[model samples]
Target: KTSLVVSYTTNGYPTEYIPTAFDNFSAVVSVDGKPVRLQLCDTAGQDEFDKLRPLCYTNTDIFLLCFSVVSPSSFQNVSEKWVPEIRCHCPKAPIILVGTQSDLREDVKVLIELDKCKEKPVSEEAAKLCAEEVKAASYIECSALTQKNLKEVFDAAIVAGIQYSDTQQQPKKSKSRTPDKMKNLSKSWWKKYCCFV
Candidate 1:
């Protein structure tokens, strides 16, 4: 089973602009199958995140904490608050940090500067540091608009989640599939032919 939780914040705060939205987070249970569960949570700030916690804890194999690369505040919120909150409940879950909206860096920079003047600066470097501190399995930049690195981000997250799961799984008994198995068979002409073959 696989699952995902995505959150976003738009506008800013106090003034209350429209909350940012998210594309569906999807997963395939098999190699050539449609996703069993593709959930989207389009909400603002901590409220949406709080609503997502239970779903994440219950269903998700990987938690992708995504923030707009353009919006420093979004990254800051994840690193400083959201990630910790999620960890408290799902500490073992693998986290994949996604820096979204990479295509809108210029516009985002302007917004960031404005926020900075208003004493609400967003720092990309700071966000990266925070991701490192929290031991993110991977960090990637993506753009939903252009679909840049979208697959890469999710693929990395899935890979990290699978690796983490494999590490946690109990070792199973080894199944013999070697010369020993062949030797255990009857030493008939057929067996010899099979062995040589």
Candidate 2:
């Protein structure tokens, strides 16, 4: 099972101050004593996504969609566009919603002013709503720097993948034979006949 972390951006430019965000995304999960492969990409909006959609469609089992809780716009972009596009390409893929920089709330506030020249407050309620709308299998508030809640994120993803894999392996049941068929196939035919006699 392959895992991909998807993030969207306007143009090919990385969302202004997300370099640290990338660095902190080092969450790890192991399957059957083997480490799972993880991929990170910036969809770069519709144009870039169009080019990458085919690749994702053919590959990828789980997607961890991350956005900053501080930036409502980023959350909106993923909710309105990225999530749907990824779902369309990989319908069966399990998705985990992650809110990054849980330890850097102070830094997030500073960056918001520096990058956008405006102050926007982070809202936990809004993040929860976004997570719900996207049908996120699990939601994690994490910090890549401190590694807080990072393990939980990967753990949840791995559990979800395993559960999904197990579900797919379950054998399908066929329709049961009718009463007449059961009677004919009974193992105690001689006993029934002797009893009757």
Task: List all candidate RMSDs to the true structure.
Answer: 13.4, 15.7
lDDT of each: 0.51, 0.53
Over 121-155, each residue of candidate 1 has an lDDT whose tens digit, in order, gives 33567666767888877777766555667667655
Model 1's alpha-carbon lDDT is 0.51
- Where in model 1 is the C-alpha error above 4 Å? 1-25, 29-52, 108-124, 171-197
lDDT of 2 by residue, 1-197 (tens): 01113121111223234322112132233566755533333333345346644453343445667777566666776677768877777677677787776565667555667467564545667777777888878777876555567667666766665565445434465356667755754422211000000
| Count: clashes, candidate 2 | 0
Candidate 1 residue pairs in backbone clash: 10-20
- Which candidate has the highest TM-score of all? 2
Poorest stretch of ten by lDDT in candidate 1: 188-197
